[model samples]
Every structure is written in structure tokens, then in C-alpha cells.
Target: MKTQTAKEIADNLYTGVVSRFGCPRVLLSDRGQPFMSKIVKAMCEILQVTQHHTTSYHPNTNGTVERQNHTLAQSLRTYCNDTHDKWPSLIPGIMMAFRRSVCATTGFSPFYMLFGQEMKIPFDIALEPKDSLPQDTRVYIDQFLSNIKMSHKIALQNEAAQKEKDKVRHDQTARVRTFAIGDLVLLKVHKFPKGQSRKLCDKATGPYRIEEIGPNYTYGIRRISDHKKQASLVNATNLQPYIRPDPTRQRLSQEDQNIPPDPDSDSDSDPEVDQDDEVTPNVDVEATQQPTPTPQQTPDPATRYQIQKVLRGRRKHGRREMYIKWLDGSCTWEPDTCFDQEMSDFINSRWTKQGKRRKSYFN
Candidate 1:
């Protein structure tokens, strides 16, 4: 086929998809030129099909279709010559092979599930006995319908069992994260083009506030810095809880800068009160000396950085340093002295926002 324009795409969709399969309730696709064109939009509006586009960077939303396309391409490569221009001629044979193959989820071939009978392959017709007798018309019709019902029942049971297995495997390593209205979240950013170095690129943008929760685990996000405009719907996979920077750390850092030199220890020393100093009335010395709670240690609403991955066993100048990736956008190496036990474990845990099944545990 030649390069298709907007009108051609719409016309082909109406003839090949709508006419054949009837109107779809919803259409999900990437933001390709054909899908985004005005002609396609008008066709969808007229057909009453809700259109949804996946986010720019996250291609997993349409993973199933991508996988099928990969399968079709592989089949084509096996059937076509080196030139490959005539591969479209073999589409019918490829589709027939696919329809006859049993799916893992349904545990039935697409042709058998739809038509309630095995397709008559060329070999079946060529190798059949010439003297085979045929059954009565009424009896054949009744028997065919009975077999269809049985196949449908088996398909349903297989589908249910597959769903259960997937759920159990997913939940084993899943990290469940729930967001309430008014909660702050960091949106993962994808501005860099393909083939660019992403090692130091900013992975996320915004300490955005959750304006609304939409269906299908999508969250409506708006920038905290700019609340006037609402951004696109973000999937849970691309979002992570934001942990705000701790003020106490800054305060302690400042105090460390002003403290006088400790000639004995050769390291920074805590300020000490002289024995001759008089204690003030109504003031508890022990209470004043207690350490302030950090943002990570408390259930603070202003949390911005949630540690998701930890690269342990790293060293800086022969001292141990841990590299951590946060939910928002930080990937940095830090000394062990900087984090407490709780924070370290949280970083080490390979948690994701969507709670998807990971191969390490699921496999």
C-alpha cells in the first residue's frame, strides 16, 4: 500500500474494521499521525467510539497488540522472499494459521471459539476417504450446536483460571500504592528522544497535586507551581509518591558549619554545655536535647521522594555508598551515614507504583 492520508485511514477503518466487526465501544492506540488526524476523530465521533491514546513514553499500555504485530511479522518473514514486497499476499494464510492456533488465555483456537467447529484444512479434504457417509441434516445441526456450547463452557473456565493465576503471580511481588485526593505525587517525565543518553536525564517532573482520580487507575495531575492548567491523565505506573526535603537536615548542616573546632576528635562535635552553666527554671534540658523527627521517619503529608530501587555495594573513596532511585526523579549515590535503617530498607525494596508482576518473583 502507498502512504495513507487522513481520509484514506478513516475510510479503510470504516470498511475493514467497523463494517466487519461492527462499532467498537472504545478504541485505544498510540498517538500516531493517522489516529490523531481530524478524519479519524470525526469517524470515531460519528461511530460513538471513545478514543484513548497512550502516554508518549509508556508503550506497555498497548503491549498485547504490539505482541500480536510481532507475531505477524515473524510469520511473514518465514513465508516471504528476501525482497519482501509481496508479503501482503500471504496475509490470508498467516491469519488462518493464527486463528487455528490455541491462545494461552482462552485455551481455544480463535476460529473454533468463534465458529464452533475446527476449520477444514487442505490436508483434511485431500486425505479423506471417498466412501464416508454423511449424517442427517437435522441431526447434524443439533449436534453442531451442542458441541459449540461445550466448547464455549470450556473456554470460559480456561479464561477464569488464567485470570486467577495471573492475579496470584502479580500480587506476590506487587507494591500496592493508594492515593487520596489532595495528595502530592511526582510525575515521571519523558522529554528525551529515542537513542539519547538517559543516564543523567531528569526522569520525573512535578511535585504535582492529585486534582482528580479517573477510571482505570488514571490520576488527573496539575502542577503545584502552576495550578491553573490541568495536565494529561497519568497512569499509576508512571507516578510515585513525593517526599519533601527535610528541614532538620538543613538545620543540622548549618549548625555543623558554625560549630567551633574540636581538636581532640578530628571530626565534627556536638555542642556541649559547661557544668558551671546554670539551668533555667521551667526548662527541661533532656526535652530540649531530643532529636527532631525527619520527614522519612514520620507520616508527613509533604513527602516528595519515595525510594523505589537501591544499588548496594557501591563505594566512594573506599567508603561504602548506596545508589538509590526515588519515585520522583532522583538517582544518586549517597553515604550510608545519611540514611536510617527504615529509609535504607525502603530504598532496597524493588517497589513500583503500579504493583505489576516482576520476573524476579513471579517467574
Candidate 2:
């Protein structure tokens, strides 16, 4: 009796058991409130259809539909095997692509059966119409039916192979760590000037004192702004340790003018020991001399900044257009424009190992 979204109800009608899927002269669903709702009943009415909520408590009668659900779910799982490990993020795209592609089920795709045409998928560039007539099509209908059966067998085998491979990969990477509470950590700020997220220059934006942590998946961060204590709990996937410009960080940048070259020439070289001893909370708050930031050749943007959304979250799946302000106790981040594609590629080309990098729509 659970209520469903309009999207959910429409999906049921489009791909559900009733949609097996000749157009319904009479529609049949359960006595669920969603189907009983005025909008839903109105749709059936508009189609000149009959709505039959099955006779109360007659569970045996709905076996055909229930069995179809299991069969369909299995088919769907086979169709979307998440082979690239990115299918979850690309679910909408994948579904959209699959729905519009040719299928073996009815000698055409679901799109074709419902809409009377198979849509040309984006990747099929060689698709061209042949000079075959619908009158000729009836002559070859039996061959088309035979082809559908063969295609289904081939697809099921491919899908099962893909699913097994995915299972193996999942088993292999089972140890990928999930974030837990009370761990000190660092977050990479999406701090790109002109909305560019590819800048390696923006990586170490925080030693952001982790304040409180969440149950197995998130952490709360607090940036020091004196009296204004601002905090946000972000997922652990978005965080990495703010490695504060380690000179020995395997690959050194061209920007080594900030810290002088390592001098093995001098002994008792314990700058770290000195700095560690001096970084007590009382000393930071109560001392006269402010701690000098680690020097770099290029003047970087001020690190501790507040970001604000210019757009509302309800639109576009909870992503917001944002502006960040620098917190060097000086206003620094210039936020006027969106840096879409060109700047991100420019930053990526700087990487020593410039493999393919995914461009997030959020960026």
C-alpha cells in the first residue's frame, strides 16, 4: 500500500509486467494508493482503459505478475553489469542509452515496440536505412523471430560473463577502506579559480582540523575563523590528507623556490622538531609572532576560505553553483565565471602521468 512517485508509477506502466508489453486495453494493478490516486486513474481513463485492483486478498491470482518481476529484475541485472565500476554514477545515462537501443525481446527494442521506431544510438554511426518494404517485412517475419531468439541467447551469455567479471573485481578490491569517525584527515578543496577542478595547485587546501566524525562514512570539518565556527560533514570519498607540500613527496614540482633545496651540508637540521614543539594550541593563540605559511615560488590563493552556493539545491540533483572566498584574513578568491572544459584539460596536461581523468559535471 506504499505510495509511489509519478516517476515510479510511469516506470511500472512502461516496463512492468503489464508492459510485456502490448498496449493495454484494460490495465490491472494492485489496490496500492499510488495506483488509486486521481492522476493515475486519470491516465487510465484518458487511454480509455479499465483499472482493476485485484479482488482483495487473492494473492494466488497475481502470481503471473510477481513471477514476471523476478524474471525482469534478473534481466535488468544482466543488462547493467557495471563493467567499468562507474555504472552507479552513470545510472541515468546507462538506462537512457539502453532503453533507446535495439533489443532482442520483441524483434525490436522496448523503445520500438512502444513508439513504433528504433532510435539510432549515438555510437552507431554506420546506421542507414535499407530499401526494404513493410510488405516484404511480413514475408520475413519468421526469420526476424528466429533472430530475436538467437540474439537473446547471445546477450544473456555476454551479460552473465560481464556479471561474473564484475563479481571477481568486487571480490579483489574488497579491502577498499571506508572512512570512520574520530580520524584526523585532510580534504582536497574543489578550489579552482574560474571553476577549474583539475589544478594540482589546489590539492593541499586543508589540514582542516576534523572536528566530529560520522558513522562509518563521513567527517565533520571546522575551519578557524575566530568566533564564526563553520562546519560541514562531508563524505570520506571526497577527502585526502592535506599533504602540506612535502618536498620529498616522490615527485617534486617545479615550484621549489618556496623551500630551499635540501641541505645535507648542515648538521642538526631539525626544523620539523622545532616547528612541532612550537605548534601548541596555547602558543598559536597566545603568542605574538604568527606562524609563517610554508613558502612556495608562486603566491597561491589563500587556503582557508568559505564557499557559498549562488544557486538552490532542489534543482539539478542537489548540486549548487558556488563561490569561494579566501580566508588569509584577506578577501582573495575571484569568482566571476564558470571554467567549463578548456581550463580543466589545461591543468591535466601538466601531470607527469597524464592518464585519462574524468570530468565531473559538478566541476
Candidate 3:
């Protein structure tokens, strides 16, 4: 298509489908603006076509089309390397070549699969005699039907076998990771815009809290600092756990260090003597030696609590409650509303739209 406008996309879609094979029962596409636009939606609705979108940013859901596009692009680049401006004109010839070639997975050319016979090219016409057509029309029709049926059956079996092999190969190196609602994770950054150095840019950016666990290993994540949710659901492949630092260990280490004695005071010095020549007041020595009781410091309501991890979450009386493990070695079942703004954002990110609650634990 010349332009990606909704009108252009809708026109192309109508011409491509309705003019040829008629409206399909279902239309599956990515979450592109043109595919999701009102025009295309209205068109589908009028035709009674069920439209479905692949998971955002996950191309494997629509892998077949994606693979076809990749093959087409490679073919175009090879044929149109010197004639860049005329690449569009070369598409028909490239597509014909692709359709006539035998596919590894199906063990049949697309042309043969569609028409129940091999497509005759210029080379075949020049080197071989043309086969005579069947004299009986009924015989020809029956033979053609049988050939197509057998081809389709074998193709399906071959496709399934290829898929099994692909799955086995994929599983050999695949690492599975899962995140629960309220777990902090770093989102992988995939795009670096023009004029930006990819090496200088961060590989991932987040400390985003998972709000919902979705189908196909996707997670709804929101930034912890800004409380802004990601526009698209992030795939598990692009996420890594964000391990929060332990404040208790740091505090303990600080307490364990010994403080050097003051240089100005000596242990052998008299207890009542004044350093500046002023006489000390007459008071009970034991009372003077007694250590004053230090008041316990209360936690500030405005302070953002360092969450070590979220242990469990649940919806209680229309409000979300979380069992949080704090960095200070304290665990509490606090209502979502009790947290400050940033903490509240983190808590809110863990709840799904359906309000289903699950227990999340650290690995």
C-alpha cells in the first residue's frame, strides 16, 4: 500500500479479500493503527467478520505472515539492489517465483497445492512436451478433486511434523521465566531512534511493577516512579526481575562499626573536671553517669517505603491489600490506600482489571 492511512488500508483490505476469496470468517492482525481503526472495524462488522489482534509487541502470534514478509523483503532486496526506485514493479515476478518454489515444510509448491498440478514455467515449456488433457470432463474433474484432497492431507501432516521439530529445537535453548502481579521487573528496550547511539542507551528501563499477568506470558507493567502504565503488555522474554536492595543489612553494617573515642577526652581524666576551667555542678555521680533513654522514631507517613518484595496480594472488602516484606525486616498486611503516592502506584500495578488476586514470592 502507498500510504498507511486507515482509508487506504480499508480499501486495500476490501479489494484483497472480498474481490477474490470473499470475506474470511476471521481476520487476525497486529495492533497497528490502520488494523485497529474505525474504518477497518466498520468494514469487518458489515461483513460479519470476527477481528482479532495478536498480543502487543509479540510477533510470534502472527509468525506465518511475518515469515512470509521477511522472505518477500529478502527477495526484493536481491532483485532490486541496483534499481531501488523500481522495487515495487518487481513484486509480482518475485511472488510468482516464491509460489512456484517447493516449500521445505509442506514438500509441495504453493502453486501445486492450490491448483492440484505443478505450474509450467518457461524452462519446462522449452525442454518438455506438453501433456494431453483428459478426454472425459467427468474423469478430469474427479481426478483433480482427488489429487487436491490428497495434497492437502499430506501438506497438513508435513506442516505438523515441521512444527514439532521447530518446537523441539526452540525448547532446547528456551528459558522460562514468570512474573506475578506486584513483582518489580526491568523492561527490555528494543528501539533506539535516529541520531542516538544504541551502546550509550540503556538496555532496559523499568523497576516497573507488574499489575496483571496475561495470557501467552504477557504482563501489564507500570513505571514505579511516574505511575504510568506501559502502552503495550510486555512479553516475559523482554522482562527481568528488579531486585530491591536490603536496607536492614546496610543499617546493621553501620551499627557494627566501632566509633573511635574522642581525642579531646582521656579515660584517665577526672570525671568532674572541666576542660575550659569551669567547675562542674554538684550532683550525684551515679545519676550523672546514667544513660538517657532514646525515644523510638516513628515512620513518616510521607516517606516511600523500601519494599523488599510483595509476598501476597488479595482483594478485601472492595479494597486491595498486600502482604509486603519491607527492607527493614518487617512484614505487614497493609491496605493499598495506606501507601504514599509512589508506593500506591506500585501496589496498584499488581492488581488485574478482573481483580483476581494471587500470592507472589521471590525466587
Q: Residue-wise lDDT of candidate 3 within 1-363, one digit each (tens)?
A: 778899998888889878887888999999999898999999999999999888766798899899999999999888885748999889999998999999999989999998999998888889997668658889889999999999999999999999999998887556668988899999888888789999999998979999988888988999999999988777898899897886643432434444443443332156665646754554543244334322344443223466677777666655567777887889988876576655565445655533443334332
- Can you give the TM-score per candidate against the true fold? 0.66, 0.25, 0.66
Better of 2 and 3 by TM-score: 3
lDDT of 1 by residue, 152-184 (tens): 999899999998998888775555466878888
Local distance difference test, per candidate? Answer: 0.72, 0.50, 0.78
- Looking at candidate 1, what is the lDDT of residue 287? 46
* lDDT of candidate model 1 versus the reference: 0.72
Candidate 2 segments exceeding 4 Å error: 1-164, 170-175, 194-200, 209-220, 224-233, 242-363
**Residue-pair clashes, model 1:** 8
Per-residue lDDT of candidate 2, residues 1-363 (tens digit): 135775578667767645685558877776666777887787777767787664333333365678656755565676555564543555555556656766533334655544444566656546665655556777577666666666566657766776687678666534323544444456655546775557545564545556666644556666543422234356566666543454543343556435442344121254445544544455423333333234434321121122221121111222222223323333332322243333333323432222223342223
Clashing residue pair totals per candidate (backbone < 3 A): 8, 0, 1
Highest lDDT against the true fold, candidate: 3
Candidate 3, residue 162: lDDT: 98
Candidates by lDDT, descending order: 3, 1, 2
What C-alpha RMSD separates each model from the true structure?
A: 10.8, 20.8, 14.5
